[model samples]
Target chain A: MRGLFAARPLLLWPAGCALLVASVAVAITIGPAGISVGEVAAVTVSRLGGADSGLSAIREGIVWDLRLPRTLLAAVCGAGLALCGVVMQSLLRNPLADPFVLGVSSGASTGAVLVVVLGVGGGALSLSTGAFLGAACSFALVLGLGHLSGGTTDRVVLSGVATMQLFSALTSLVVMSSADPEQTRGVLFWLLGSLSGASWPDVWPCLLVLLLALPACLGRAPALDALVFGQDAAGSLGIHVARTRLALLGVTALMTAALVSVVGAIGFVGLVLPHAARAIVGPGHRRLLPVSALAGAIFLVWADTVARTVLDPQELPVGVVTSLIGVPAFVHILYRGRRTA
Target chain B: MSLRAEDVSWSVGGRMIVAGVSLEPAPGQTVGLLGPNGSGKSTLLRLLAGVRRTSSGVVRLDGAPLEEIGRKGAARRIAVVEQEATPQVDLTVGDVVRLGRIPHRRAWAPLSSADEAAVEAALGHTGLTDQAEQSWHTLSGGERQRAHIARALAQEPRELLLDEPTNHLDVRHQLELLDLITRLPVTTVIALHDLNLASMFCDHLVVLREGRVVAAGPPERVVTPRLVSEVYGVRAVVSPDGPGGRPYVRFLPPTGEAR
Candidate 1:
């Protein structure tokens, strides 16, 4: 699947994209409401035409309000997170890089929990705003620490670890201090990344982030390719390595923050999907970015579908399924790496 | 185009690593930068290639300061192959070589036919055309070095800078690599540890000691036994050898008295 197809990357990408489209279509047919693909398609087509599908109220609400937006949100978060993963890995020049490696998710969780505990902004504190601010704040701390540590690859990762631990401790402290059990339970759900609150509003910002960030990523693929050789080599190649790293890192962080604020932090779609995509398309970011995005969308759609139906009326957080899958996938990567070495 | 460094020095934490050093080979000549470990050969090469800004003094490319020349403009004319540049990713040989064309290609444009031709030509020059499809990790050490040279050739630059390009090659590959380098129609500065190879292939040699240029001239003139003994701090005999009568170095074992 990896080597033979790499000779024809152009041919492989279209196939992967078609698989994503087909998977999203099939995934929408899932969930406890038992909507069929035909009904899903009819409602989607009628909605696109600004007309009603004339289905029964229960099925229409299931098709439109509950399942469709959640499925689309899953696809959006998956694509954005995966793209961020690709960027972080290339910028840091480490295969272990992911969206949460710099403590963005921890910071977001802290912001969300702070909102839940303190009841800030006179009850008008949207969790996303607090989460974005928290992400920005944590990123600043990580950068400051990384800079002081000379900004080496391992030093940056170490700084991220510090930031993550500090923010996680803060988040837990807030949860423990909260007087209301209901608020603490809500914070826990968000921390574990439940897509149950997915809605039409959650879909647009993610879609907007994707629309702006994906093209930016595509345009920088060549520069990112040069960076795989390291900063000195990239500088010799006429790429302003420092500037490029900062720009791409900012773009990836912004997009990842947007997704995390919406979907809480979906882990493995960003971590594992890029490696799978790199295996298929090779390390060139031009092909890896889009293929990873497509594969991520497909992976999350199916995972979320399983999350909705596996327990039957008692929904499991999608993060749990992703981690369950991600751990084994990561082990396989390590096992393969050792065998090859 | 010619490249020159005027009293270049680099320092960090208030300690100078490369002191005031200056050398300029005649344009299109093959110049060898000869020094032992910690003598600052690699540091000087980086300064000349504009990969590092000198703490003091200037690097001139065709009489213009390196910083004023701009990175893209310098890259179009200069290609650098640093020591110990092992790619962590599993890039194919072709993929790595195609990267040399980046300085010449538009940001989003596909590789043009000229770019493809240059890459193929570089592969042919470095004897890597047959291995273009092979994954980089599968290559032998000499092949990896040659692949990097092929990448430098693909840049189609007017000047090539290589830091210890022969550290991984065996005897025959080393000879072939130096032969190919001497034949290229570009200005070349190579940092080398092998005294004999430097004397044999280099048209001119610049010897550095403690971050300073101690001697500079044609290999036969500058590579004397006394100069080698003084810079390297060991006894060595130098004699003219081969058809071209280039100086050859023969080292004597260290004497207990010296120790």
Candidate 2:
């Protein structure tokens, strides 16, 4: 199956894309109220500017107001996270490197946790704002440390790992000390990552960020290809290695932060999605980035749907389900890598 | 283009690596830099390629200081092929060569017809036309080196800088690559450990010992037995080869006596 996909990237991308659309449709239909697929389709069509006769108000609310936003948010966040993962893997030249692995997600989680647990601000300044601030600050610190250490590739990755560990410990402290039961549960769910409270308001910002950053990242594909050969070679090819690294790192952090702020920290989606994409499309970023984005969207839409309806009334955390699925997939990839070697 | 490095000195990690090295290569001339391991041959090449900032002195291309030209501008003038390059991702051969045209390309622009022509010509020149679509990891050592050369050739720079471009190649590919490099209409500076190959291919020779130039002239004038004995710590017989009077050195076997 892997070889078949690898041999036919053009064929596989559209297949993944079609599956993603189908998964989104299923996601919008499967929830607590259990609307029919026909009702879901009618509500979606009416919302998107068609006739509205077949859909009931309750079905519309379930499909359009709640599940639609949540499912779309899941797709956007997944795509962004996966795209960020592909770029990060190429930029760092380490297959193990991901946005979360570099500690960006942990940093955002710490910020969101502090906001929820401590009620840092009474109004307007909410957990999203806190998460964004945390993510931005940690990313800045990593870049600053990278520069201070002579701007070498090794230095940047080392700094990212160090900052990640520091923020993760801080996040744990915040979670352990929270007094309010609801606040603690909220904080914990945010850390583990869930799309439970996703709304239209939350979805727009992530969509906006993804749309803005995708073109810029795609423009960098060739330079990113040059970078895989090593920094010296990239420089010899006229790439400003330090400047490009800083720019790419900043863009990836912003996208990761935007996604995390909306949907919480979804682990392994960013880490493993790119590898799967590369396994299919090879390592060319132009192909890898887009395909990974689509695959991740499909993967997360289904994962989110499962999280919501697995127990009917009580939704499991999306992060737990992703972890459950991601670990085995990750192990499979490692095994394949070993066999190839 | 002509390249001139004057009083070039460099230090890395507080240890001086290149000291007072002055050299010049005329347009379309191939100059060979010869030294033992760690004698600053690679550092000097890096300095010329603008990959490193020299501690003191100037490296000028044509007449302008290399530092004055930005990376893209400098890359248009000089292309470098380093000794060893290990790519983390398995890029196809064509993708690797396409990178050489980056200095001429805008951030978002696709490859132009001219760029494609250059890449195609480079592949043809390096005899890698058949391997253009192959993954880099699947190539043999010689093929990889040829691919590296093809990348540099695709740059179409006025000057080419190479650090041990023939390090891992078998005899056949080594001769083919050196011959191809020699025929290019560009100034070339190649650091070579093999004196015999350097004598055969390079127009001028610059021999270094302990980061200082010990001799600089035509290969025949500079590659003498005394110089080889003093710099390389080996006794050698210098003989003429080919019609151009290239000097070939034959080293005497060690006598088991400590120097």
Model 2 spans > 4 angstroms off: A1-19, A36-38, A48-54, A121-124, A177-185, A331-340, B6-9, B12-15, B54-58, B64-69, B171-173, B233-245, B252-259
- Best model number under TM-score: 1
Residue A117's lDDT within candidate 1 is 79
**lDDT tens per residue, model 2, A1-341:** 24576566668766887898888887787765767767777887888898874766866787888998999999998899899898888888887788775567778988887777776776567888999899888888888888899877778889999998999899878777764778777777777889997889999999999998888888888778778788888888888787788778888999998888777888889889998887777776777778899988888998888888898788898989988998999888778766344
lDDT per residue (tens digit) for residues B99-121 in model 1: 89889987778789999999999
Per-residue alpha-carbon lDDT of model 1 for A34-117, expressed as tens digits?
Answer: 777788888988879957777998888788888889989998888888899888888887888899988899999998877767
lDDT of 2 at A314: 88
lDDT of model 2, residue B17: 93
lDDT tens digits by residue: candidate 2, B1-259: 4789999999978888999999889899999999889899999998898888789999988789988987888888899998889787667898789888888888777689999999999999889998988878788888888888899989988899999999978888788889989998889999998998999999999998878998999999999999998889988899896347788899998777884
DockQ of each: 0.68, 0.58
- What's the CA error at residue A121 for candidate 1, in Å? 4.2
RMSD of each: 2.1, 3.1
